[model samples]
Target: MSGHRAYTPSLRDRLTKAVMTAAGYLPGPLLRPVAGAPRRVDGQVLDPHFQAGLRVISLMSEGEYQDLTLERARSVVERSAYTVSGRKIDLAVVTDIVLPLGGADPDRADLPARLYSPVDGDEALPVLVYFHGGGWVLGSIDSHDATCRYIADTGRLKVISVDYRMAPEFLFPTAAEDALAAFRYVRDHAAELGVDPQRIAVGGDSAGGNLAAVVCQQTRDAGEKTPDFQLLFVPATNMSARTRSYELFGDGYFLTRGNMDWYERTYIRSDDDRLDPRASPLLATDFSGLPPAHVATGGFDPLRDEGEAYARRMADAGVKVSLRRHPTLVHPFVNAVGATPLAKAALSEAVGAMRMALAY
Candidate 1:
């Protein structure tokens, strides 16, 4: 006791700040050696950075957050995403618009959308109508802002983020209807949106991905011109949730079987609705005449098998299909770009795919 120094909060705070600042200024090449690359582990190529991030998140969460109700989960996940995603990047031009809900009686008061364009663009460009992934229950344009920005900037195209109606409140077919409506709205007003009508595509992630697929199906059924291309990221293609991937990766993964069960029950009106192509696109008898497709899946995600199945079905139906599976990533990895190097790398690949598909 006689030789010991007294504890000082101010000194400790200064020391912490100095350490963080020093680490922040380290060169990228110096940090790259510590970041490490993806390596094989148990038949999966796991990125060390992602694994470390998952562990930190698991420590911070996975406890004292047992309630999975819609309200509670939404707040927690959104905050988590915002914290993990850091800051939003600045695009050349970003704007918000209200899309008029068309058809018999117009509901212009409902739909809201955001548009993102590359910083280097000034002329008419290709466009993609994008939906946000949240199992038809959770996410929004704000949640998928970074993902949309990545695609828009990387592809040098205008990207429209549609705020579609979600489940329980709107129920089945409503989101799909909104997706198609947004697509049509954009196509009809492509000139005003500074995009070429003939070069427009459709895309989404998870539930959003499902909506994009349903939009193509509905377009074909309605005898309307289909989108030039479609991009789906770990989409839930089937409501049945009976795939082998469900059994293998359903529990420990970020997306669980129980959550899917809840989402289906909340979104579908009845058991019969599960079989409807509008709810489960995988059950559609015909996959013909849809746009060229890009389907991506995370190997550890519960929806992987069904997404891959849908892609295969499209390919067999003569639709040009490209499927990419990230064997070690979990669901929603695309939204984790700021937290994990692996996710950032995967997102780059996805954005590149869109650039090619959109011909930008």
Candidate 2:
């Protein structure tokens, strides 16, 4: 601890602090060297810097306290060889197709969506509206395309990944409503999109995953049969620091306590809204009658405990549930299918859960 690097928040941290102070109330890995590059699947060489970044994180976070920020979040991973190394990660990951939203509304939430469909489907098929994760700040349809494409091609389910309004600009329920609109639209044109009204689902990762959960609650409160299942990938369920997860694994993993503190402060503008169930599902009184759920968590992620607890809570309430944990992976590894070896296996398990829920 004596040789520890002095504590300093990253760029994302400074930005978060600036925003919070403006409001006046104040808020807020391992592996050994294996020579040139570790041999991995597909004959791809492991990025040495990634391992280096992990070392840096461990050196700094061993027993220290620091402000979390998206910048620091990126620094730990980006500093790795993945982004800094000379080699380009130009793998054609996946293809995206843009779809036009018909109607002369003149302001039809202009956007481009890449559709992924099941293997066989003649009539209406089950559709799953999705939102990508970036703490309600980062991430786009592009970042999550790989997972969507896999669902479309393998599960045979029509996966509609939505690009919603993010924060510091359009926080809180903005993304939630956009997700609901996409689902309602998908339901409205079930026949055209080849989607079955009764079989639609909603899901996403991290922040996106949180949105998916909110969408489910929104649909149900509106007196509608919610998505057949809610697939939350390492979702940030609670905004406040009341949960045991927040207290237990606050730091040390990829998703540090700092990263979360910064994210919640950024996403929630009105302090009153932080307690809203839509904003933080953990505060919701009722978990009954919600749709079935399949939640995945990375063992090393700070948010891991809450996700697993939510799954258990749903099961206790009689809602069907399955929670899977990837002990060796980080928060964003699920979609790094080609970049990380654990991705394929973990995603496959998730896809299986989806297929079972959709029963297609």
Candidate 2 lDDT over residue span 1-360, tens digit each:
000112334675444334322322211112334112342422233233223334443644423223445444334332221221221222222235444443576334544555666444465767778888777765566556656766665565678887776665666776666677676777777788767888888889988888888888788778976788888899888776555545555553456677666667777878887888878887777788889999998755678777887788778889988888776566665555543435556777887898888787
Question: What stretches of model 1 exceed 4 Å from their correct place?
Answer: 1-42, 62-66, 102-109, 119-122
RMSD of 1: 9.0
Whole-model alpha-carbon lDDT for candidate 2: 0.63
Best by lDDT: 1
Q: List the residue pairs that clash in candidate 1.
A: none
Least accurate 10 contiguous residues by lDDT in model 2: 20-29
The TM-score leader among the candidates is 1
Over 4 Å off in model 2, which ranges? Answer: 1-31, 34-111, 118-123, 242-249
- The deviation in Å at residue 71 for candidate 1 is 2.3
Model 1, 160-209: lDDT tens per residue? Answer: 99888877677777888788888988888888888988888998989999
Write down the RMSD of all candidates, one decimal each.
9.0, 11.7
